[model samples]
Target: MQQTAERPSTAASSSLEIKANPITGQERVLTEGACALLQALCQEFAAEVDTLLARRKQRQQSIDAGALPDFLPDTQSIRDSDWKIRGIPKDLLDRRVEITGPVDRKMIINALNAGVKVFMADFEDSLAPSWEKLIQGQVNLQDAVRGEIEYTAPETGKHYQLCDDPAVLVARVRGLHLPEEHLLFNGKPIPGCLFDFSMYFFHNYRQLLAKGSGPYFYIPKLESHLEARWWAKVFAFVEERLCLQPGTIKCTCLIETLPAVFEMDEILYELRSNIVALNCGRWDYIFSYIKTLKNHADRVLPDRQQVGMDKPFLSAYSRLLIKTCHKRGALAMGGMAAFIPAKDPEVNAKVLERVRADKELEARNGHDGTWIAHPGLAQIALEIFDDYIGKERPNQLHITRDVDAPILAAELLAPCDGSRTEEGMRLNIRIALQYIEAWIGGNGCVPIYGLMEDAATAEISRTSIWQWIRHGKSLSNGKLVTKELFCNMLTEELAAVKKEVGEQRFTHGRFIQAASLLEEITTADELVDFLTLPGYRLLTA
Candidate 1:
């Protein structure tokens, strides 16, 4: 089915100006119809989007005032009743291994051809959302859907093309809090969530449905069932507008936020018609947990590395997610394995073993699938799932586990003795600066010390530092965490980065800007909700 572009909406009362930054090949994807569709969606939903964002602030205020989130009392019946989501689409039924990365052209081709069951073409955490990058990401997805996506590296002289069989493509859009500065409706930037979802669904739904797949998505940073309901309404409206079946689009909500963890069943209930799975977005979940409980001394987290999945809080969260998802007959996906294979054989062997163990744990614990950041780890994850779930696509869903409210609550409030260390503080400072510099320069995913670092990791780094400083945390060396200490560490780390990246690159590049931005956010008296919002301004400038 060839796409029929809708003419740009011309109603003076509702017309929106398209202020997107021009890219060389953007015209192929951002058609008049696409703009019209996005404008219409934004105009229809902007007010409601504002209300939802305000609700997020209200809820955060409550949390800061010593309120704890629990299963909604009004929605207890939804949890009590035994109901399941709509059937999983055939293509998404067995997602034992999904690879995730930014939506760069080369990444789009390589990820799809990487042999994972699904490639989560990420526009959220893993993407640096410059206007050109965002628009070009949509263009890349459009071409990949048509199986015509290819890339030739200018420096490497290497060509990338799709293989005979490619992974299913699932797009992860930016969260609700973000705004697409380049795209405006009625003189205001539209929500990034609306822009990304509307554009992709507008252009690719028909083509994807015709190809035996539909527009699958991974919703991120959702804080409540109401937010899920908002997305449900959008899906319904888009399906009707596009003249497609009501349940054609399937989504998997990332159970990443503290509020979201308590409302998993409710979230699924809200989007029952189109929801298919729930993923353990571990990194952001940790960040959210820390941010949510920053004021409570007992809930202060230790070094970021100390907070692993094995921790009581994370383990309970994982177990509850599996039980909740499987109880609803939805796939319970595992968190990411962010460790990239190293060049040293000994290091690579140790890392691969850790990856294998992690996937094996997920497989055994009833996760239908897991995520791998690098393609090289895909086979390792796949083999674990294949060995454990052979012949049966997802063997563990049928097996049930018990999870009670007290268990979850206890885990959420679990105390840790893990100590902060000078090394950890220095590492966080170094990573925050390095990652932010790359992000400001239009690179979202950076490999530092053999791990794939993205926004989620970066968030944990900065937020942890902020929390430590705010709470007067003491490092193992008995030094109190203070703005002065952080500033001193930042200076040393900046010098190290300057030397590592070379003075020329450091000066001409965004390193100074990145360091300044990181210092400002980390030392600020008030916590900033997102690094991207301020960072986006720099990109636009």
Candidate 2:
């Protein structure tokens, strides 16, 4: 089932064709054992990943033809039955604050010591999946797992290392939709999720277990219960292969897609053996809402800024996630606080205040914990969650929130309130243009304006504009959104971006390419599923 490596100093799988240049640290991360695990994972589960992705397209076609997602009748009995997931480890129980970022060595060190309970080293949204970045990231995490990670800034010569009490580490693998472009197994690209999960788990699972933790994960972009089942099968298969305990590989699934909300109970049941929590992947969920209902004029969203967790649909989403998770004896982790800390004192204080308020809302709404992009936002979130849950408790899982009325599907899919404006449209256009530029340039986590823009937030920016133009929606200024209007505004925004970033940076940067790509997708005949798919081409080339 495995192909022998053609060369000693290359990707270790002969069955897997290495399509990209080998990075400096690729050898250790893609060791023979790691390649073997990847081959095994692909052999057993890769077909299912393709099938599930095809299922997503089939469902989207139905949605385009006027069908809405609802609870699964086939899984009603599973949802109704009283059951709980396998027990959580001690370190995972008090995850009141968790931070997520690209798996950069320095960033990983900083985030681990950021005073959060967990640091999710991300291989998904936050990291642009360049071959060098992916290989280097695996190496960094391997070092972190062994407590030998350290870095020194070249310009400043500032050495950085882990603190005495670092946060627990979790890995967020790429979604099933993404493929590891650098490697192909059995004549098809290996699923990026399996590649990442295999590499990390093979290298670090033993070390983490000895340190009183397994290889915890944050599963993203699940759209249905069957996807959850696929992961469950994957987890069990890996555990059996590795000769580990059945429930050693714990995870917290991200309810990011529009359809996932309707199947939360079944999703929990599917992974109950090893799953421990459900994260409110709000940004992606918003993006999914726009994409899923793009054809429905009545469901058009307003300005991106107006779609906060307080909105009817988002609020219902948060509450339902908590209710579903807590009822199923799992932690309900909150969404990301996208705002980053600023340099100016006033601006920084305002940023902290915003984060605090957002965390407060989450805590009051019964989330067991929350996520922050920057390490600086950790204190604000921890203070809020700590005040709510206190030092005595690990999580708020005991609070099932059973008293609330049922959250209807309509409420979860309600149109966001507030007016779209020429300004909001312009902001969306600018952010999409610049964010795509950065992403294609091998950086996925970028600070555009004040907020951190990753694939999820950027997805909202581009798709919102497309949805507006698709439905001929009007701004508060009474101006109709059209392809022509959007194109004109995009040209103006591109100029503005060039001016702000200066002549040298703009000329050297990917502004023109980004602008063209942004305009193409934003004004497309149909909304693209992901801009990254196209952007990845530019990145790899």
Itemize residue pairs with steric clashes in candidate 2: 3-15, 4-14
Cα error, residue 193 of model 1, in Å, equals 1.3
Q: Please provide, for model 1 over 1-541, each residue's C-alpha lDDT reduced to its tens digit, 9 standing for 90 to 100.
A: 1122232333223456556434566666567777777877887787798899999999989989988877788998999998999889989988989999999999889899899899999999999998778878998999999999989999999999999999999999999998876656777878988889988888898899898999999999999999999999999988888788888999999999988998999999999999999999999999999888888877888899898888888888888899899889888999999999998999999999999888888888778889999989988898999987785654467746764454557675577669899998888888889999999899999998788999989999999999999999899899999999999999999998889889788888888899899999999998888898888877777
Whole-model lDDT per candidate: 0.87, 0.90
Top lDDT prediction, candidate number: 2
Question: Where is the poorest 10-residue window by lDDT in model 2?
Answer: 1-10
Question: Residue 366 of model 2: what lDDT?
Answer: 92
> How close is every model to the real structure, measured as TM-score?
0.96, 0.98
What is the clash count for each candidate, in the order shown? 0, 2
Instruction: Provide the lowest-lDDT 10-residue window in model 1.
Output: 1-10
Residue by residue across 1-541, what tens digits does model 2's lDDT show?
1233343453456676777655588778777788888888888889888899999999999999998877778887987888888778888999899999999999999999999999999999988998889889999999999999999999999999999999999999999989887788877888899988999999999999998888999999999999999999999999998898899999999999999999999999889998999999999999999999999888999898988888999999999999999888899999999888999999999888888888999999999999998887877888899899998998898888899998888898787778889999999988988899999999999998999889999999999999988988888998999999999999898999988999999999998999989988988998999998888888887
Residue 338 error, candidate 1, Å: 0.6
State the number of backbone clashes in model 1: 0
